[model samples]
Target: MSKLPLDPDVADVAPTDSALTPYDNQHIVTYARLLQAESEGADWREVARIVLHIDPDHEPDRAQNAYLSHLARAKWVTGQGRLLRGAGSN
Candidate 1:
């Protein structure tokens, strides 16, 4: 896999591939961040702005879709044995 980006350029909607993609590899950190944010009870709007970089205020539907899809992929990845890059490991 190519070196994972520290910050990925997010799609309007994250990939729909059930299997992992290059996008998945590049976004492992983003996935982890999303899961962490959700677990912390962060608001979807705030998480969307911070993690996905989509302004929910301007585009609520797009932001929500990106947030949910990426979050789902994150859960799937962890369940399928992809290691998270660990908190604060950088």
Candidate 2:
């Protein structure tokens, strides 16, 4: 499967500073959206549609999983991604 679910060009995974991945560099907006959703206590289904572009009602498992996975990666980027701020900078 592609590293990014919706947009292949936008990376969705995160690696280390020295070992940078495309997802780590391209998913900044997505990561920010996840953080904002968490802060606002938004629903996962809603977040999936708005952020990941996955419809939870149509594909429950895929949508939920994408939301959760992206959110987790986003959180990781927020913490670890900052370490490489000057370089990849999420």
Candidate 3:
């Protein structure tokens, strides 16, 4: 698996008064699942679209860009997975 990009600022800030918002956590989890399901295959553009859908008002920050790049790289390495699995699979 490719190394996930980390935002230095995110770590720089103290967590005592900081916590990921529900939306943030949701995006993170969705991204992780997308990455894992595709075996690290995820397109940055598609990921960006997903991110935008999650937070339309929020601008694409540095961390977001980094993540998109990472996803693109992963997608390049591995192909996107099947939308549907075997028969009877939900």
Candidate 4:
């Protein structure tokens, strides 16, 4: 079986908070999923469990916060952060 890219040990598989930080190339797919979920109005708890592997049942606050933080970072990347990374010119 092929390994999934969602390994927690792999740093760039998730979004970071810094607007100055270059977007992690590896998180492209993850960002797509987050955007899709946002568009579809999916619940953050479910997204946290499924996409981010965070169990809201076990750690509700942490899961909710992680989901919101990552989603916000994803949105930033697709918006202003993209400009910072020169996404359109490519």
Candidate 5:
């Protein structure tokens, strides 16, 4: 793996695919944060702003869509790939 930005710019819409996309590789850290926030039961709105850098208050649809899509991808990756999963998940 190449050097990944810990804080990459998020897209308003994430690529939808069963297979991982280049965006997914670049945003692994973002996925980790999203998963962490989800595990903590953090508000989606708060996670959108803090982790995704999207202000939900300003753009409800965009924020929600991005948040949901990215989070789904994060979970999918955790299931499909071992990169983000904790050792215990195995």
Candidate 6:
């Protein structure tokens, strides 16, 4: 995968910066949409393709893997895709 084009602002993380939060709202929404598609038996690779359209230089494999891991954990606890749906509902 090609490297993402760095945003100089984002590249600099101060000790007290709030930008390091693990769950970015936009990222969360993307992950949730991907998860929902997967739950409906949609091809994850296809979802990844669509996601990469927004951030083409993103590491698609990593993003997909993270979303899958999150979905699996949520499924184990909730037995449904509600959490994934909720994440993107806003």
Q: How much is the lDDT of residue 73 in candidate 3?
A: 37
Clashes of each: 0, 1, 0, 0, 0, 0
Cα lDDT listed for each candidate = 0.82, 0.65, 0.37, 0.64, 0.84, 0.42
Best by TM-score: 5
Name the runs in model 5 displaced over 4 angstroms: 85-90
Predictions ranked by TM-score, top down? 5, 1, 2, 4, 6, 3
lDDT of 1 by residue, 1-90 (tens): 346687786898777776767777778889888888989999999999998999999999999999998888888877767735542232
Clashing pairs in 3: none
- What would the per-residue lDDT of candidate 6 be over residues 1-90, giving only the tens digit for each residue? 333232111111112222322333324444445457777887656654554332214665564654455444434323334344543342
User: Can you write out model 3's per-residue Cα lDDT over 2-88, one digit (the tens) per residue?
Assistant: 433332112211122133333232234344444674465665445544533323236446445545544443343223221122112
* Least well predicted 10-residue stretch by lDDT in candidate 1: 81-90
Model 2, 1-90: lDDT tens digits are: 333443433223334344445655566667777888899999888988777877789888888767777777777666665524632454
lDDT of 5 by residue, 1-90 (tens): 357788998999887886777788788789899999999999999999998899999999999999999888888888876445632233
Candidate of highest lDDT:
5
Ranking by lDDT: 5, 1, 2, 4, 6, 3
| Residue 38 lDDT in candidate 3 | 48
**Candidate 4 TM-score, true structure as reference:** 0.66
Write the number of the candidate with greater lDDT, choosing between 2 and 4: 2
For model 4 the local lDDT of residue 7 reads 33
Clash-forming residue pairs, model 4: none
Can you list the residue pairs that collide in candidate 6?
none
